[model samples]
Target: MGQPLAPPPVAGDLSDRLVATDVWTDGMLAEHGIPVVDVPLVTFGGGIGSFVTADYLRICGVPTSAIRVLTPLETPWQSYEYLTTVSQIPRTERLRSDSASTPDNIWGFPSYALREGLQGDLKQLWNVLVEPIWANYYTPRAGAAFTAMEKEMHRIRYPEMVVRGQVRMVRRRAGGGYFTILTPPQGAAPTRRIAYRSQWVHVAVGYPGLKFLDDLQEYRKQTNDYGSVVNAYEPHEHVYEKLRAKPGVVLVRGGGIVASRVLQRLIDDRDRFRLDTQIVHLFRTYTATPHGTGILKRRKGADGWAYQGFNYPKSVWGGQLKQQVRKTEGAERARLYKEMGGTNTPVRRDWQEQLSRGRAQGWYRVMIGQIDRMTKTGELVEVAVASDQGPQLGSFDAVVDCTGLEADIREHRVLADLLDHSGAGRNPVGRLDVERTFEVRGTRNGNGRIYASGSATLGGYFPGVDTFLGLQIAAQEIADDLHAQGFGSKLGPGRSTSQWWKWFRNQQI
Candidate 1:
């Protein structure tokens, strides 16, 4: 996590358009006498945002081979999978989409749960309650959608290479554009720097990787149980595997979306695998008075929200509150955001019913407090909770924190270097602050146009841009920028009937 890397010695310089037009790749170009000037549309986080942008670019004739999706092969939904399929994935977990959130089509294929109702059953119910048309926004099967994206990867053969090295930094090239440096696997010295010089640089480095608390990091710094105590997002196969072997008390922290999903996942395990798992949910907010009005029980959690809102009520999305938030500053803005919401979704009634049933059954319960300390017992964990009643001690066979994901760009040294040397500055929201076009707002002397999108840009002008729709919107804006710069033409109204039919025929139902 240092300054942007110094420019690689330019042996045989080349242009970006040449990189795009070539059947010869970076590997092949070097094989010949030509140098591979990496294409401009290099997307760092090759998740949905990258996929949509790459897909649009490809069909619009921006040959898939030119776009390099530089990311770990794990799909964008890995964080999501751990919560939904708490035990094993049930194909039946219907998506809660409205009529327009289908993954099959980006721009036009806006089908909802109800649209799938024409097919049949509990699914139809899913459509009406979850996927009805013009209904509230819903979350689709993030995993399945990501799987579908991988297929698109194969179809387009997007970019001939995905260098395994992690980017440490991206700096402006001596001549123009930007120069990205990567840290290869442990022992590779020769190819330490994989230079990507482009006219336009997209820093779509999604949400920063998860960064735990000082205590957690301190524990990790001191001992090795860091693996035993998992960050809610990372790989924790052992936690579940352990639960499978023995039925014991598992403590779950946080009341956010992940917490709720994790709760259901535990319940799913109980029903599917017949594991009589006991769970305790730790919530910071005690329902003194419901936070919502009438039917909407707007109960606040922790620092904000007395009722249901992502972090704030929907009114914040469309009403005067958004403008008010715009005028706020410093602690006021943070307080305003706090007053709105964090990442918690409303307690979906279905999941709520399941938890309620579990509580009635005596298998599930809740704790109103926060973790004050932790110590390892022989085969369990000793947790001290700071409750309103007083300090209380509890023991758990395991602890799963449903705290959401919040990563810093510096988690990877290469990206850290990019920020240090490339002149990139964070936006007001504390994530990558980019211009309207999604380009990172680097210093005036900063190399090439480095833009960021997806969760990283949530602190930007648009709200909910971290969602799938947001990714697509960012891609469209980025693509428009590239098009204006003469990268290529975007496919729109001018399509022939045959081509339109071809695009339509390829959609998912």
Candidate 2:
């Protein structure tokens, strides 16, 4: 061995006192050399979820000093933009969100389409007006959304509330409330960890981590080769760059939105560079017809793809599905999620046309199968698949896995600690359980409460918990709950209108 490996800094950073105690005391923290930073509320993740909650609270008249945002990300959109970009959705590309799903503006009156129309892009306005029927649904460009969020971030003074650090764990306090352990970057603090004592804690960590297919994970582990196989969510520009350099066979996996974007990017590159790249698509389950529980709830499916305008049915936002989920409990809610959820992509005209052309040109091929094994063969990866036709094996220059996220919330350290120590429970779908008000069930410590939103709290009452609008709805519920606890002012009609004007004028709060 080169040298003996050094032990992790867990002992020094997260003291034995902090780790052993389910309920923390200030005295114990003091003894452990942990400095306590007191704030009324603490929200971790520092992503869009935290930003939206902070925005809603600020609009409801909560001061920045009363709230603290603990996160490693500098901006709310940092992680989101990175994911989108790696998945081939750059600033110029459109996001698969509704025009009204504005994370920056809660009112959503001057929607993306309206704003675009004001800026002389009348096509988006027309597209939204007669969408899905006359034309495909209109979506906002990624740049516009990020720019709006930046404006709102400055207006709300979000930076003031930000404490740059990675949150290690959260524990219930002795008297009431919670103590969150934050491990600041190296040399940023006197100690390795700082304790945040707060009455309420909000968890908005999106997904635990990326989920690699079993076969792909095994291949990577064996060969230690990340270049040949890649997840669509990660930075895999080399895949496309290699294609541009020379024509090659590529396998496009999954049938989700990211899969569509990846395919679109591949086809776009072929068209632009005049390359002879052959595209092979693999779908585990081929959808040849429409699918749903009922005619009213049916989603259009064809050509091995389920087409939807948004992530979930629009009804889940504020309609029948919302009410149905809110009223149900346990298995019924799980059943609803199963019926509504699956791999799907929106129908985009450009991609459809490009795919249709590729089909005619005999460069694009679709295979219905699950990978039995993946092996690196020379410069290419060989994949053995169990398909509808029978067993098949193929070799390609690259394999792009565009499957879903990590299902288990316990993969994240903080969430796992919550389950083990903070008395948090899992919902039917195996994520953090939360009430209608977004308060994490079973995590209440005295007068303090822990609220969770975003992907970690999916499968709760909200079916649209992962979307921008869904996050806003969660923030509203949280703000209302805080108001009930006499923390923030109520967001009444008068206040809403006044705040809307302030947002319009870009006035700092």
**Top candidate (lDDT):** 2
Error in Å for residue 374 of model 1: 0.7
Q: Which ranges in model 1 have alpha carbons more than 4 Å from their true place?
A: 1-38, 74-99, 102-104, 108-115, 118-139, 154-165, 182-190, 214-228, 272-276, 287-336, 443-447, 490-492, 495-500, 507-509
* lDDT tens readout by residue for model 2, 132-187: 79998888999999999999999999999999999999999989999999999998
Model 2 residue 426 lDDT? 93
Clashes of each: 34, 0
User: Candidate 1: TM-score?
Assistant: 0.76
- Tens-place lDDT digits, model 1, residues 84-183: 4542333356442333443334553534333345445345445347422333345445454555555555555553535555654555654566545444
TM-score for each predicted model, relative to the true structure? 0.76, 0.97
Query: Cα lDDT of model 1 overall?
Result: 0.58
lDDT of each: 0.58, 0.91
